[model samples]
Target: MELTSTKQRRAAALAIGAASVLLALFVDEPYVLLVAVAVICICIGWEAGLVAVASAGLLSSVILFSLESGAIGGAVRLAVFVVAALALWFVIKIFRTMSFYDRVYQGAGPNIADIPGLGWSAYPDGRLRFVNPAALEYVGVTADEMRRIMDGDDYHWTQFVHPDDVEASMARWHHNLETGEPVIDEQRVRRFDGTYRWFRDTAVASRDEHGRITGWYGQMEDIDDQKKAETALRERERELRLLVDTVPTMIWLMTPAGLPYYFNKRFLDWAGIDAVKEEPRGTRQFASHVELFHPDDRAAVKAVFEKSFARGEPLQHKGRLCRKDGKYRWIDSRFEPLRDEDGTILRWYGVNFDIDDEVRAQESLRLADERLARALRAASLSELSVSIAHELNQPLQAVVANAGAFQRWLTADPPNFNHASRVAQKIIRNADAAAQVVARIRALFSKTEGAPHAIDLNVVIREVCDLLGDTLTSSGVKLDLHLDPRLPATTADQVQMEQVVLNLVRNGIEAMQNVSINVRSLRIVSRHQNDGTVEVEVRDRGRGFSNPERIFEAFYTTKPDGMGMGLAICRSIIEAHYGRLWAENVETGGASITFSIPIRAADSIHTITAATADSRMGAFRD
Candidate 1:
């Protein structure tokens, strides 16, 4: 279509040229021919117009000379006309090229106006050439106003930029212009509403074929919302960092693989500034901070940490950690993995809490317990000494009395030998009894009690009552014995059982010693329970026990000169026989101590024997 149009224009130009030439020849009007050339130059093209003007000049020159009159003058006139026409064509061609470029520039204006953000172009000398409509609108300025601002003494378009950012932005822009490098900066740009917003400004130099800068094309992108969001996020991170640093405990963060990346202020302060350089030492490995842990605890702590990290498990360990002062103190270090939604370990957050005080307190408490235990054992030994003295007193006194009687009988006129001999035998018997008591005590301590045998608890109680008969009578305490004749026999060490019954009976007698003679009565009761066990209760009308629960505890006694081992030993003996002993205050204003022994021991003969020995040992040791 374009080719067809060009051909038609050429045809029209040729026809007009022919008609103009004929008119010039016939009518002597050169102005008419010049009019046709002007039309071709304006409508068609310079090439076509030049052809037509040259053809008219040549044809008019030939026709005028052919008249044979004044040929030179006609030829000069035609040559001048041809030169003028040619000159006109050249001038018109220049004008047409300029006009076409002007139209193209005008067309680009609307396209630039349609851009979303601020856009502008600058000359190579850094002077503003054109500001797009968007840029002018954003700055609340017209093209003329912008031009005036650019031409001002300042001449950098800094008026529309935030004052605080102007200096730096301008410096960067000048540097880029000088280096012919791209301009890239972020700054607050003032808007049409007179409010400043963040924008990212970028520009690149447009270079010509020679690699020289021709102009600059740039764009300002609105980043106000994004910038605010980023600022807020940064502020939030700052606040969180502050909180982590200010907390009292030491804190640290690590990658999922257990490489330490961050440590809080407290950690740095506690571990010392050099701790920051202590990297590659992480949860799985402690090569760098090995000295941070006590030598005794470092290996164990490292093992625990490595295991926890390998399994992505939470860790907790208590051990000594070295402080900046080179002192070791207990620390409870705990670390837990921070996991994503799919349970992938993202980071490990950890803290170390100082537990030195608590650890020291616990050590002090342990020392105190040891001291108390030693004290208790010492007290038990003292009580056992007193108990031995008390046990031997009776037999020694009897031996002394019998010795005196034997002497008296021997000195009587014709001293009766038989009576003296009987008295001597009594003395020997008391001495034997004293030796037996000593031997029994020695065996009890050495865990060497004789084998257990089946014995009636009632019989044991009866024997104890007989042994304390004199004391009961002297104290004016009435003794009521309610023995269960049907009581079952239980297997136990006979001597130990005898000791238990004697202690209980003696305690009852002593309990009522300070009471009124009339009301001071002791009751000894025995029963055979349905549970295949024999039970005996010794009740006293003396002052009830102040502490029923602690009465069985070693070294606990109410009497001024009493050995606290009595009930403790008795309970141990009964328990050794598979029995239990307890004390309680009776409602009738008396204290009752009862013991029950299983009818048949559950243990073998050897076990019961060992148990009896252990029970006696425990009586003093406990």
Candidate 2:
């Protein structure tokens, strides 16, 4: 049983027994109250706490006085004694606490006042110089009884010191006298009856000016609770370690300063350090474990770490790590900077993922895509030349017709007036439209590029839609346009953007190839957002896109007898202009190809990139 608990139970029993006996006596013969008074005196030392021992003694004296004065209410008087004893305990507890600070500064090191809580302890040397009032209360004795024990006693002091600590305490005293040093140990102390309490003893010998040893000073603290907690912690560690060591992936924990505190056994085996169960020396630090990385990949990996140190950002990168057998493998490492409540970096923690297989697969796919792109571009210039000629024929014919009309007007006695001027304007507009198409093709083949400039959205729409206007009419396809008059200009390559619109229109027309004439229609719409973005949407009344997510994959096509590069190039051009391009099946019926470009002024005079400029979101909002 716990020593404190046993002491408290005994104190309770004594209180009840004394109250019962005093009540029976006073109720029968009033003179017997005098005898019951002696029992109170015997129990006076029960409150042997350093702070309340004196107060308990004084209150016990009151009960004795009451009995001498011929008081018949002995039990009620003792109830008053308990209340008065508590009042005195508080007063002395506060006084003792204050005196403790005073004594600490006066070179009388800590004494009983050093212990503020009600815990058990006894004088180890067959004497009671300072017993806390709480210790007295624990043993069915009162403060007056405790003072008598302090002044002089045999049975009381004998029952206090446990048998186990008596010899150790004696040996420590002699050792302190001989060596002039303190002795510290943990042992059991005897309670009032037969119980033992756990305690941690601290004793030191005083020194003189000449370095000579004087009398020893000491304290014994209760440690049963601390001992129990330590035992529980050890058991928990075993369970946690068993789980960590058996995980499929090797795990490690490192300090923010790059020190590794733990590495499971699997991690040790993976690193090829079989001689030691674990590399205790290397496990303690990040730098110590650097030798495990492939030397060639170290510089780049080190630079990636600057984000955490210099910018206070997270550190994340995939780098090669060397195994014990000198074979280097890749590991995806991620470290996040930790900060204190005040926003100061406290440390960084990290994790690693083995992504070697994923990395190899991506590299393989990249090579295959590059080869396919090369094969597609290897198309014959002779064949392209024929197609270009066929496309250029109609514009040439219009030019010829406009010239003929002008000549006829010149030959007329009276000119055809506005007819010649309008014909000449048409000639110029058609020539510009043909030139813009050629320019788009040339720009697409350029090696270097520039940021998009402000372009009139309506002008692009009208010219391309008008060029395809005749084709749609002849193909029995209906067209609808909803253009915003005050729509803001877009920052995009004009001819490239036009080609995108034209391509979508062509695809829409193709989807309606076998549809009823009434259903074979395309609608183009434009709207200006409050945020400086203009959206262009091409809606068709026919078939929808298949697998929208995969549709944007390079070379993934929806059309047969088509290069499939057209829509891909359109997507690239739209994205390059800091615009978004996507196709989704509209809930109504068909697919909608919607794209949007920022319509704001250029962010800066210098060339700008996504990384170097205000983001698209900011740019559009601004």
Candidate 3:
């Protein structure tokens, strides 16, 4: 009976040890697990408790190993389990002798406030419960003095807060106390130096076992530098806003998806669109903003804006906008995306430029140019007809004289064969001369019929030179052409440009007709200017003009028989292409006539079309 009782006691002890080990292994809380381990060690001794821990680890390893397939994985998991179990054993053994609640109380008690920064605690009545040594130093007062200060009915802390921020700070503090919410506020406080500086105070309510409020626990951080920086930034933003509103151009800002958010005062006044009142909630709601644009231009402007916004591209478009006085005026609107450091777009900044006057001026200039071109064409046709008649008359008179001689020789007594043959040759030569004159006239008229295209200035100059090869030779003028190979192609009426060059060359030849053959030199140069325009210069070694500027005027002439319309027509053509034409007298006694046409953008089909559009969009530099 004694042996059976001893065996039963041993069995009971084993069951208790097994129960403790299982509880320690499965319990979620560390303190509870430590308590269970302590109970096991006390009941079965540390040696036996270690054996139980190893057994628990072995069980955990077996469970983990079952989840993995490879031997290496299983071994790693077993080693991990063993190390974790050993570590837990040490922790449990070390902490088993200490009280958990006592350590927690020590950590969170008033003693914890004796840290590097200012720390404090307050009761439910908003009275100071505790203040650390650092807090006393921050407030420039001793513990006794702080206690005395808190004893007063009015909060002494309020006296330290900036007078401007005192009321709001106190109201927030009272609200936090009543609602049991965390207090987080930045307020200016009087420092030890008697100067005000910003401080960020954060506090949360400390609760008791019954979840009742105990006290307020918090830390006060010096944030004077941060507050100063924030203030400066706000001031700068205000200044920038003022600048934007006062600027001549209308300015606005929108979200990345093109929803208007801000409009400068100038924009609001001009557009008459209240950005605040017309705030959009979604993409569909923003479509109503299109009403500010003219009905004819709305669809096109909206399409361009949508495409640019969606693709994160810059926006550029010209459209009519409704003004405050119910008048529609043309505007050049541009949108640029504002992006963050990582290149993520944050918002869109825009500007609307009033271009109504500029557009109207351009249209008027265009109409005036058309009228001038018609007048010049009529004048040119009349002069050309007279010139053609004179040229044909000489060749026709020669033909008539030669034919009469041929008929007279053939009719004379039985044909003087050799003389008749000579007369027939003379007749043939004059007929060929008249045919050549007709061909040149046809070529000139054909050029006037064709439109402008992207053509090389060199090619045009060479063609003109070929047509006037005989004329140059007859006038004893040496033609020099220094064409730049790298010259960009110009968008111009090839025929008109050729005609201008021809006129200049002819004028040069005429001007030097009285000079010696060796000195009568005509130089035609085609080159690319620094400003990205194609410049053609026709220089002559002749009697230079006294007033080069007036030479370009209509019906202004230097030569005795000069119509003076040549230079005028040339200037008008150059201006139509957004180019400039000018003449200057050379110091060495000659004239240099130069015209520069802007090179086509390489992708445009028309010369003046794209250039005119671009010029109307912020081309005026201030």
Winning model by TM-score = 1
Candidate 1 TM-score over all chains jointly:
0.64
Relative to the unseen true structure, what is the C-alpha lDDT of residue 5 in candidate 2, on a scale of 0 to 100? 37
Which prediction has the highest lDDT against the true structure?
1
Please give me the total number of clashing residue pairs in predicted model 2: 23
lDDT of each: 0.78, 0.61, 0.71
List the candidates' TM-scores in order: 0.64, 0.46, 0.54
Candidate 2: misplaced stretches above 4 Å?
Answer: 1-248, 251-263, 272-287, 296-319, 332-436, 448-455, 464-469, 477-482, 488-494, 504-513, 518-524, 537-569, 582-594, 600-622
Whole-model lDDT, model 3? 0.71
**Judged by lDDT relative to the true structure, which candidate is superior, 2 or 3?**
3
Residues 227-322, candidate 1, lDDT per residue (tens digit)? 999999999999999999999999988788777778889988997856545554454244555558999987987788878989999998999988
lDDT of predicted model 2: 0.61
Write one digit per residue (lDDT tens) for candidate 3, span 46-90: 555688566656665665566668879777766765666567676
